[model samples]
Target: MKHLSILVPDDRSGPNTVACIAGTYHAFTEANKYYGTLGRKPVFKMELVGLSKRSELVNGMLMIQPQASISTIRKTDLIIIPALGGEFLEKNFVDEKVSAWLRGQYKKGAEIACMCTGAYMLAATDLLNGKSCSVHWKSAESFHQLFPEVQLKIEKLITDEEGIYTNGGGYSFLNLLIYLIGKYYDRQTAVYCSKVLQVEIDRQTQSDFAIFSGQKKHGDDMIRKAQEYMEHNYDRKISVDELSKELAFGRRTFDRRFIKATGNTPAEYLQRLKIESAKKALESTPKTVNEIMYEVGYSDAKAFREVFRKITGISPLAYKNKYNREAAELLFMNDAN
Candidate 1:
């Protein structure tokens, strides 16, 4: 059987952390049950490994007892890091023993999988330096600020590179679990698990769920005012020249400051703001695509559709169908009647 170590870090205590651990454990065990039904032996010998034999968490309300400590585990085929909560500071909760153990395991040819913010721990080891990984969209800015060396792909639901895997935020880790099941077990088994677990198979991106609020944490007062103007006047045509003149800065200097502060060019920032407004209208109002396009300052239908798809990974109509509150209410009423 393949050895699977689910490392329960010292600070791994949160609402999502517990669910990720329990959910992943159940998924793997259920996969083994499916294998047994087919007259095949189980694949994984799973255990909760920790720094110590017992770790109290969540202010001592919960206690996790590991079957083995990292010191005792000589080798494992796979290591799974559960999602962490509270904060993303590396120095705050990182265990040096865990980091060394992870690096040692990787050198010994063990595959690593980090679920959601667990990527923070993995990244702390410097293994993800210069590597592409995904994290929760809400944590993207913080992760970027801390680990500028690691390529953060917030739009991706899962990233697999050279045997290191990272998944996106929230319950989306279920998709990653399904993906591993497909890889280690079989496609048929993965499909069975997807059906049993009610998880969508082959999900690739989380962009549709991400809300793009313009980054405004920098200390550029002029850029902040410009951003506020663009946000308030998103439905109007905005020009960089006009903004620069209004802010009393030269065009080139204004562009440089805007990019430095917001990590997006003025045009790109405006487009994102318009698209975000369009997304809101699509979700809440019974508006046609053209109506929303015009409402968000887009005159060309093709350009609007392309920008929407480029940023959100879905078409306008699809977004509406999935999120339209009016359509949902109408369907509910029809079913009731």
Candidate 2:
């Protein structure tokens, strides 16, 4: 396997800069964990290209680099352009030197990836015109106003076609890493990497989960109370009776309203919740699948695997194998280059 050389850009932000860098850093670190075990480690090198000192007034922070140069960036295979502080989207084009160096690298066939308004820099190159890409939904309106030539996909987590890839927002970094892991290795490696990163294994490709959809609604006060209890007590064996007593509602009332508000009955909700938790456990830790199954409320590993397949559309072992293969492939590629 070869190492994957990823270059992450830093700029001073409310622009979501830290989140973007954190995403790449998380993926790179997790990828390294498995790759190192097999004797191949990705070479990670960070560079501060332009703007020796960057600061955001609202964020109350400043970034000062004594050694700022684009040398390392010029030699990387993958360049990750992260959003700067709040003005990232509203800011004008980058300075000429940084822009030119990036353009030179892209011209030479390097893979260029951007997150959130980092797409703004990519768009400045005029390379994304008429090509479909993702921007954070919050900025979609202004982005469209500024760069009407580009096609915007707000619902998707990441958009990849041709050599350039753009993500919807900073959070989509997880999906991007998973996609990359699957593309270069297999599914299991991504899952394993996600697990090691302590992220819940998300099988759903769509970014809009009902839990995180627009307009965060505070449902019935009683129902919210019930859910709060359930989330905190996932490890405990609690019953509908117990919930009803604690919430001061009768068993009949608790069951009816809880199901109506959350769209799932208490027992069913608990099962799904535990499954979600178990999925994370499977990925992040070195525990056996059976051990994870038991830890997440399933007594039988066989049944747990079956349910996992039903929920995630792939077996646990398959997911792990896929990511392992991807990390191996990325390591090989980086080393060869």
Candidate 3:
């Protein structure tokens, strides 16, 4: 049997932390039952492993109980890290005991899976250095600042590297759960669990969910002005060269400072801004894709679709059909009829 240990971190990520534990535990147990019906032995010997028996989280609003302490687990095939509560990069994330235990387990050939921002804890073990990871879009910047060597793939709902697996923000972990079920169990069983759990199966991208707020935290007044100018003029065509000239800086200096301060070239940042506005228009307004495209400063449909897909991983109409509730309902109802 494959031994499975799900780490119930000493710090909880609010009520969702417990939900992650329960979701993982429930899925594997259901897998066991599926195998049992076929007269096969259970696949996973599962335990909620932790450094302690219990932990309070979210200002004592929630509490979790671990079934086994970390020290008790002599060997395990897989170790899962659930999303953590509290600030990620703070001193609390540097839980030396848990970090050391994780490193020891991985060295012994245990595969590690981290859900959502729990990558922070996994990264704390220093095992993820030079590995690709996916995390919550909101935490992407912070994670980069803390672990630059860890390649962060913010657009993916899940990322797998070597023996480590991670998923994006919130309930997207369900996608990773479904993936593991299919990989370690069987595709049929994975489909069954998705039906039972009511989770979307085969979800692969979190790009549609990411909000591209400008990264303007760096201390550069000129760059700040450049960003604000782009923000206010996103609907109109603005030249980066002209903007640089107006700011009294050479184009090279402007581009360099913009990339340094915002992590995006002026052109890339402007594209994101236009795309973001177009996204809003698609979500809330009853407008044709062409209209929204032109309104967001893209005069060419082909150019607009290409950039939209490049940034969002989906077409303009697809984004609208997915997020515009009234349109989705109408389209679904029409199809149902």
Among the numbered candidates, top lDDT falls to: 1
Instruction: Return the lDDT, model 3, position 257.
Output: 84
- Per-candidate TM-score against the hidden true structure: 0.90, 0.53, 0.92
In order, what lDDT does every prediction score?
Answer: 0.89, 0.63, 0.87
Instruction: Give each model's clash number.
Output: 0, 28, 2
Worst 10-residue lDDT window for candidate 2 reads: 207-216
Give the Cα error of residue 40 in candidate 3, in Å.
2.3
Instruction: After superposing candidate 1 on the true structure, give the runs of residues whose Cα lies further than 4 Å from its correct spot.
Output: 90-92, 220-225, 241-263, 329-337
Tens digits of per-residue lDDT for model 3, 173-271: 888998888888889889998998899999889989999997766779999998999999999989999999999999999999887777679999999
User: How well is each residue in 179-282 modelled by candidate 1, as lDDT tens digits?
Assistant: 99998999988999999999999999999999998777777999999999999998998888988999999999999988877767899899999999999999
For all predictions, the C-alpha RMSD in Å is 2.6, 13.8, 2.2
- Candidate 3 Cα errors over 4 Å, as ranges: 89-92, 244-257
As a whole number from 0 to 100, the lDDT of residue 96 in candidate 1 is 83
Please tell me which model should have the higher TM-score, number 1 or number 3.
Answer: 3
lDDT, candidate 2, at 304: 75
- The positional error of residue 93 in candidate 2, measured at the CA in angstroms, is 3.2
Order of all candidates by TM-score, from best down to worst? 3, 1, 2
